[model samples]
Structures are given as structure tokens and as C-alpha cells.
Target: MAAVWQQVLAVDARYNAYRTSNFPQFRTQYIRRRSQLLRENAKGGFDPLLRRQYLKLRSQLLAQRYGPLSEQSSFRAYSNSIRSSRTTLDRMEDFDDDLRAQGARGHRRSVSRGSYQLQAQMNRATYEDKSPGSVVPTSVAEASRAMAGDTTLSENYAFAGMCHIFDQHVDKEVPKVQFANDDKNRLACCSLDGTVSIFQLVPTPPAVLRVLRGHSRGVTDFAWSISNDVIVTTSLDATMRIWATEDGKCIREIPDPDCSEVLCCTFQPMNNNLTVVGNSRQNVHVMNISTGKKVKGGSSKLTGHVLSLSFDSPGRILWAGDDRGSIFSFIFDMATGKLTKAKRLVVSEGSSITSISARSWISREARDPSLLVNACVNKLLLYRVVDNEGTLQLKRTFEIQQNSSPVHSIFCPLMSFRQGACVVTGSEDMCVYFFDVERATKAIVNKLQGHSAAVLDVSFNCDESLLASSDARGMVIIWRREQK
Candidate 1:
């Protein structure tokens, strides 16, 4: 009985192994048979013969209990077979004309038989039996010409209506002009035309109401009071003009005895009454805007031409950039009227300072304030200013652009309508680009292009809703963001 049981177990083990091997062979044979049928169907272009065979196979397999086919597998096989058959049909249809032409030529030659007659027949056949779709030079050129013509159609369609015409021409080759927006009531623009224009910002079909003209020569820079009531303009005419924003009348024009051309000017944000003007001779003069009198003992002299100037927080410190790419900070004692020179910040080689501004709401690790300066050679430099016992020092420097056109002017505001701190830069290439300085690497996120000439100035409205850009051709373009 024990021998018999062992024998029975041995036979059962052999049977199981055979079944395992046979199952794989059965699967392999089934796949091979299906593949052959699909290839035949493809070659036949899914004709009635192939379709009938496919439907019969599907029905039979589904009816079998051990078909071992999933719904996904069946669908995949059907889709692949259909795609292959369609492709084969397309190919055959494409070459049908060529096959027909070759067959016709063969029939003509088979009917044509000695030396002279055979030679003549061969020559005639060679002349008449030319290959179809012959490579004619004219046809090839025509095809190439057709392709080239289509390439330009896309660009012409894209820029179909990108042109406009306007009126009025201001012709003074302004380097850059600063714009100020105050309380949505007053709009001030300082131009190299040696004039400051203050217009009322009205709601209905906005337009310039008045033009404030006081300077003798081209006005190089200007700034507006926080209350939007007054405007200060510095010009190449060796004077800084203070004007009333409400009217086009000039309140006072303070003449600079030492420097002839005032390169830049700005009002102290904290002290709305004080204005600082920098000249080509590297000198800064602080004046009482209300009285048109220079602040007593407030003149300070440096080395290079002062290109731009800005005031730090509290109006106690001033940051000035020069044509030599050197930045200096000065401490202003409002009561004592003393100007003490501070540290000079170094910048990139071959770069000259173009514009400067101090952040308002955004503060860094420094105790005093952070300064943002734009250079002529396409870079935005960020410096951390530390106030150590009244002496301002440069703490850090962040380089913005690596290889871009030299920036002609820059404007940095405390807050932007879109998001974080924003800096707008006008370049010599007649374009304006915006930058986000708070983020690392300080990437340029947006650009405005419309100026026919080099962009001379760029500024944002107080609310950051409107952007104004002026070019060398005396064109002023105001752009507003598209509302979402």
C-alpha cells in the first residue's frame, strides 16, 4: 500500500510539470497565430476576408471558458490591428498610380522583335518609357518656392495689426525723464526739454491739462512731492525749478553757481520740503523747495559726474551714484546742516551709474536701509546700508543682469501692484524691462516694447497700475495692465 501511494504521488508530480510546460507552449502558439493573422489582415487592408476572420476569432475566444483574455487585452489587439490595416491601405493607395504606370509600360515593350529593327525598337522604348514623377528641376524649384512662401505667412498673420499712428512731437533728445503720480490727482513729468509739466489726472478720456515750463535748457531730472502739490525739476540750464502742481506756474528757480548741468534730482520722502540736486560736476546741493534757498552749508562735493541720487529711510542719509560707477552715502544733519561723506561702493567694470532709489516698505538686515542702483552697462546693483553711529556703510551687493543692453534709466518703488518689490529699467535698445529684486538671482520677469527710439525714461504710477515710458524721439507711451 505504501509503494502504491508513493507511485501515485510520483505520477501526479510528472503530470503537473508537463501541464506547466504545455501551458507556456499554448500561450506562445496562440500569440504567434494571432500575430500572423494581424499581419495578413494588414497586408489585405482589413478586407471582408480579414474582418470576418477577426470577428469569428473574437466570438469563439469569448465563448470559451478558458480563453484567458481580459477586456483591455482584447481592445488593445483590436486597435493595433485596425491601425496597421489602415496604414497598409494608405500606402497601397499612395503607390497605386506608380504600379499602374509600370504595368502599362511593360505591356508595350513585350509586344515589340534583328539587329537594325531591334536597335530601333530599343531606342524608341527608351525614349517613351521614362519613369513617372520625373525629377524636373523646375518642379523641384517650384516646390521649394512654395515652402518658402508659407514660412512668411505665419509671421505676417501674427503681426497684422501691430502698427499705430499718433500726433505731437517733442524734439529734445532727452536722456531720461522721471514721472511722479500723486493721489491720482496730479501727474508730473520732468523732461530733458528743460521743462517740468504738471497735468491733472482726470478720469474721462485722460489728457494733459497744463505744461510747467521754467528751466532755461533741457531738464535732466525731476521729483514730485508726496502731497502731489509741488514739483522739483533740475536741468542743464544750471538751475533747479520748483513749480506748483495745480498750475503751470513756477514757484522758484534756484540757480547752481558751481555746476552747470544738473544730472539728477530727488525729493526727500520723509521731508517733503527738502530737495537734493546732483550735477555733472559731482556735486550735490540740498535746497529748501518752499523758499528756493539752498540749505545753509548743505553743499557737498565728490569726484565724478553725479548721474543719479536717492534718499534712504527717515531722510537722514542720501545715496548718490556717479558716472564712474561709484556710489557714496552721506549723512545729513537737518538741524546742523552738515553733510558728512560716507563709504564709496564699487561696482562692475566699465559700468556707469544711471539711476538710484531706496526701498520704502521692504527692509533688509541693515539698520539704515537698502539701496537699489542701476548702472549704464546693464546691471542692477543692490546694496545693504548699515548705519553705524551715523556713518553709513555698504554691506552687500547683488548683481541683476549679466549680458543686457546698458540701462539708460531705472525706477524702483516700495510696492508694486502685481506682487513684491519691482524695479523698472529703460535700456539703450529702446525697451523697458521689469525686475524683481527680492528674489534670488534677481530675474527680469516682464518687458515693454513700443518706443521707436532709445528709451530715455520709465516710471510707474503711485498705484503701479499705469506705466509711462518716454523715448529719445519725444514719444511718451502709457501702458496699463490688461485686467483679468
Candidate 2:
């Protein structure tokens, strides 16, 4: 071991002279040789400086090629928020775009001066006689009373409105009936015989205006436009026809894509040019009345065949009842007449939702929380729409237990001149039943018997002054408030 150590020390002493500063020529030549060797290295190709530059250029190119498009909304907003380095003109354009987006999201219909005047006139006309203790009734009210005759309504019930059949439906099925908005005296009805009957509702007898004939099959339901100039009818023949109500001329017959037999339909809340129809397949579809084109995107389908439905404009929601006793709701687009965001709930086991009445349509309903009434099987359900978000909360139910069997799907909700709340629907027996809507007790208040057969449909005028019903035998009856 001592010999090995001595040999290693002798070899280190031999290189000590080369490592010293005195060998300046040797140090210079050695450095040049090492540099040349490093330049020709086989392992790592680029130096750190060159590698960093390459990486920077590559990243720039990739970003330019695959980055988000500036035209998209989210990207534009984000770029604008971070683009202090961009030109002022560019930033201004982004700001304007954001403003336009906000405007679109919060778009609302404009009210003109003419509309305001019309609204004021309507309010005055509606309240002229009913506001307070006026000695005499409005001429219209008095005329209504004289026309329908009077009966003293029960304490809990409002006017019993007289009941009389205007015309017998040739077909056995009851027709769907509706009174026009601008003129409550104008009643439009759908017949099973592929015809629509227009009648003037006054003077103890309703005179026929015009009979509209276009549907190849029986008509199911129809709606009077807000202007009361047009009537839209959905038929079992898989077409919805628009008619000029004044002359009873068919304007157009819009075809259903599925031809699945439209069971029901109604007009869009704000637009008279839009109509929505529900089919036997439990699907809802929208069409442009002016163009007769099916709306492309917005619509919904339910799990059951839609029998009845109603629209709530402010809530941007629609409710529909189907044959399976299911009520489905969806968010509605007022501008485009489309339906989306659907939810379904089965309310009854087997009964179809026969009728739907929104709160505003009800007489003297609470306006804060929107309300809707559904007549299912033998019961009436009141659902309160929460926060104008189409959320339905069961507020109350009115029913007749046992021995009642099933009632007609018709419900007529009315607010009386005295502010009484009442709802009327048909019973399996040859009678019409009235219940107090504001009460939770659910007792039968009155039963008006006039129809020899099942009363299939009922509607009340703007006021509780009159009630109209249709029976299985195609009899249309008008019931007027009883005189005190």
C-alpha cells in the first residue's frame, strides 16, 4: 500500500508545473482545443441561448395559429378587458359590442302613446260602474243581466249566470268555446264537424255571424287573437288554420310536420303573429303565423298527449296538461315563440288535465305571485308561480270526495263585481259545481243543473257577470248573474 501511494504522488507532481501560470502559451493552446471539441459535441445540439430563442418563436407561432377567435362573445369581452395596449378605436368597438349584448339580453317591448291612451280608455270602461257604490249599473252590465236572466247566487258563490243552449252541436262531442278579448259578446267555437261557429252573444239570443269551414277533420281548439280580428284553430287533420274572423275567411292552413293530429293550441302571449300547437304525441311546436314556417329551435315535448295549456308572458313560462294527468312546464321565448327548459310532473294517475287558467285570467286573483288553476279528473289545483320563474308551488286544492266519480275537465274562474272568488267545473252527473277558490276548505258551494249530459267546457267573461258552458250533446249555455 505504501508503494502504490508513492507512485500516485509522483504522477500528480509531474502535472503541477503545467497547471501554474508560468505556462501561458500552453494554457492558451489548451483552451482553444477544448472550445473546438465543445463546438463539435455529438450529444446536445443547440446551446442554451439558441434553444431559448427557438422555444420563444415556436410558442408565438402556435398561439397565432390556434388561439380563440376574436369575434366570439366571451373571447371579445375578455380581450377587451385586457386590451389596454390596443388602439383606442379597437377598445371603443369592444365597448359598443358589450353594450349591444346587454341591450339584447334585456330587450323589452316599447309602449307607444297610442297604446297608453287605449289602455286608459279600457281601464275607465272597465271600472266606470264597478268601482264603488254607484246607484245604477253600467249599461253593459245591465244589458248582460237582462239578457241572461238572474238567480240569487249562494252566499259563498258569485252569480250563477243563466244557462241555456244556443245551438245543438250536430256531433256528439262537445266543442271548445272562447269569447273574444276586445268584444266579449263575440264567441268563437270549434265543432267536431270541421266547422267553426261565430255567434254574437247578446239580446237573449246569439245571432250567427259566419261559419268558417276549412279543416278536413274535426276542429279541436282555437284562440281569438288579441286584436280580435283573427281566429286560429287546430284540427285533428294535422293542420292549424288562420281565419279572418270578421268575414270568416280562411287565410291559411298551416300543416304540422308530423301530422300527428294537433290536440290543442293557443296564441303566443305578446305576438299575434305566432301560434303554438300541441300534438297527440305530447310535443309542442311553434309556427310563424305570417310566414307559415315552423320555428326551428325553441320547443318542447311532454311525456303525455297535451290536452290543454296556457301561457304566462311575464314569467316566460308555459304550462301544459296531458292525457296522463301530467303537467309540463317550459321556459318560453316571447320574441321567437320557442319553448325550452322543460320540466314534467305527474299530478293525477289517469285523468287528463282538462283545463288551465292563469291567475290574471281568474277573477280578482293575487298578482304578486302568479297563480294557475288546473282541472284534473275531479279536482281543482291551484299552483303559485314563484319569483316569476315558472316554479309551481301547490297553494291549494278543491275537490268533492267519494261518490263524485269524475268531473268534466272544464273550469271557469271568475271574479265578481263584489270581489267574490269562484271556480266552476262540470260534474259526471248532469250538474255544474262551483267552489270557492280563495278557501282551503274545499267544500262544494253550489251545483247548477241545466245540461242534460256532461258539461265538457266552461268559460267566464272578463267579469263574473256571465258563465258559458258546452255539453257533450254540443249544447252551448250562457249563465248570467242572478239579480239581487
Candidate 3:
């Protein structure tokens, strides 16, 4: 036993010396050879011992050359090799362990190291690996730790730490608004310069495809119909224009009845041809767009001046938020032209409602139901509609406080089909925050910062593969998940 231990120690010492002296050359040769092998055997065919030796040698060489450029390439190659080796080892060891435990003798004896210790080392190495191609087991805690250690995540968090300075740019105090189409293929942004820019995204390199100029005054709000072909925009000039999305042609201009400033307008998701427009008078009017005529429906006046509105498809409920910090829900009967009261829920004490949006489709209790998410000036509220004796009632309120700046826009999208539910919120503080709603806490999963001005709008694609954000400076940024 003493002689055996001595032989092991001598082998290790000689290996260390060889690594120190010729490791860089060995690593370069090994990488080039392995890359050629990988190309030949596309699935990667490498002996276990050779793979381990390569990994050990590469790690030593990488540690020796520790700098930005050197570390980047070495880490990348090491990560790819480890991932391929892990997969090969896992597949080869699949049924061998069970067979050995069943009293069947294998070709080689079992190693002395404990399984738990080996697993623990693997976990640690996975956590420490920062390369893009690192392979990790599918564990929630491990995935979270890996994400936390990502450099991109750290940079974004640092950027979000900056607080928003209201009136930061008095000269460029132009209010900006942005909205994403139903399909999220395009994003339309309007600024105070009487310019409405439409960005086409789906392609490899996204670019601005069309610029619509019909509003003489600053555009306040706009909504894309469910079809995504027509867009209606309202301005401070008390005029609303409907434009064709393909060519940016103004189809019709709907003048206000009393010349009251059109605060907001949205297309009814359930009724494609009808649109509901709200003004400073706290009244809601439904109009038929095809005929350009009012739908012969009487307007419903809520408590305070209307600020924003959203719809919940599951409950067929329309929520109207007002300046008095109150939110009212009404159910409309299109055939009878009647409106039924659902519930009057108060959101905040002094803060007015700014924006409202519904969480995209979600699967709950094996049924797909849409959730209603609302954003007040200083708070974020979420409520679920429950069926109680055939009446829809707001069930719960999950509140998130904004300490630095007011919550200007809140967007909740199902980021991952495997992960339960996630939401991203952008505030006037020029910061974008990500939260996992299934956790039911304000634990920030990630943050993004690029816009120097206030972030006005945020939306995610249908597949949740990309996130698009627009700020007050007419800048639009699209973020996509880095593929491994």
C-alpha cells in the first residue's frame, strides 16, 4: 500500500511539472486536434481518460493565461469539451451501474471515491463555470445559481441600480408612448415630434420599416387591433387617425365630438370591428370602425377621470382605471347594448393609475385563463378573476412597491414554457425589472438597463424568445436570450 501511494504521488508530481512547462502548447495542439475530430465525428467521439486529461490540462493553461481575451477563448473551448464529455459519459454509464448492483461483475472494479462527494464536486464546478457552453444538470437551484453568476446578469443589475431623475431632460421632455402588436412581430412608437415609427423585427437584423406622419400634435396613445393590420393613434390635438400598417397610409380620421383630449383608445379584443375610446370626461364610447359610426351604445361614466383601461378575456371583463386611484369593471352585452357592473376595486391611496395590461395566456387547473395585471403610480397590483355564484369577482391583490420612481409601465409574459410564470416591469426610473410571479414575492430574477430616459413600454414576443423595450428618447432595444 505504501509503495502504491508513493507511485501515485510521483505520477501526480511529474504530471504537474509537465503541465507547467508544456501545458500551453499541449492545449493548443489538443484543441486543434479535438476540433478536427469533432468535425469528423459530429456527435463527438473521445475516450474518457483522454477527455479528462484534456480538461485538466486546459484548466491549468487557462488559469496561467488570465486576461480578458485569453480567458474568453480558453473558457469557451474548455466549456464545450466538458459538455461533450459529460454527455458521452452519461450515456455510456446509463445501465452499467444497475447491472453492477444486480450482482453482475463488470470489466473494471468500482472506484473508491464516494458518489456523494463526486456529485458535490460536479455541482461546484458547474457553479464556477462561466463559459457560454457549460453543461449543468437540470436542477432549479443550480440553474438559479448559474444565472446569478452570469456576467450579463451582473452588468444589467448594475445598470438598473441607477435611479430615475424626473425632469432629467427639460429640453427633451417630449412624452413618448409605445405598443407592440398582438403577434409582437412589430413595435410602434410615437414621440412628441409628430412622428410614428414602426419597427419590423422578425428578421435577423431588425430595422425601422415605416414612419407614419399624420398627427400634427404630440401623439399620446395608440393601440393595435387584434388582427394587427390597422393601428389607431390619438394625439393631444384632439384627433384620432387610423392607418394601414403595411404602407403607413392614413385610412380615416375620427374627430372628437366635444374636442376633448382623447386620453386613450383600445380595440375590443372580443369584438374585432368595434373600438372603445376614452377621454378626459370619464366616459367610454364604443364605435364601429368599418362603418365609422357609433354602435348606438350609450356611454358609461365611471367614478373619476379615466386614465387607462384593460380587458380580461376569461371573465369578459373590461377594467377602467381612473385618476382618483379607483378601478371599475364592467361587462358589456353587445346585442342588448347594456353594461353590467362587476366590481369597483380601489388600487392605491393617493397615486393615480398610469398603465394597465393583462398577463398573456396561462395554463391553470388544466384550463387556460388570462390574468389581469394593473400598474398604479407607485404600486403594482395583480388580481385573478374567480367565478362566485356566476358573478366574476376580483380574488387577490399582489402588491409590489416602487421606492425609486413611479411604475410607468408593467408587462407580464410567460418567459419559459417550462417555468411557471414570469413578469417584467419598467418604471420611470429608467430601469427594467424581472420577477417570477409563481414565487409570489418581489425577488428580482434579472434586470436590464440601457435607456437613459424613462422606460415607457415593454413587450415580449409570442414565443417569449425576445423582449422589446422603448424609452422616452424614442430608442427601442430588443433583448434575446443568449443561446447555449
Which candidate leads the pack in TM-score?
2
Lowest summed lDDT across 10 adjacent residues in model 1 is found at 153-162
- Per-residue CA lDDT of model 3 for 406-452, tens digit only, reads 23444443222223344566666676767544554545667787777
Better by TM-score, candidate 3 or 1:
3
RMSD from true fold, candidate 1:
30.9
lDDT, candidate 3, equals: 0.51
lDDT tens string, model 2, 276-358? 88899878887788899888775677778877878763436778877777887777775666678566667776667766665
Candidate 3, position 443, lDDT: 52
Root-mean-square deviation per candidate: 30.9, 31.8, 18.8
Write model 1 residue lDDT over 39-69, tens digit each, in one string.
3444444455545555556545544623443
Off by over 4 Å in 3: 1-184, 202-204, 336-338, 364-377, 388-411, 414-416, 440-442
Candidate 1, residue 247: lDDT:
65
RMSD score of candidate 3 (Å): 18.8
Reference-based lDDT, each prediction = 0.53, 0.58, 0.51
Task: Give the TM-score of each candidate.
Answer: 0.58, 0.63, 0.59
Candidate 2 wrong stretches, greater than 4 Å:
1-163, 313-315, 361-365, 368-376, 400-420
> TM-score for model 2?
0.63
Residue 459 error, candidate 2, Å: 1.2
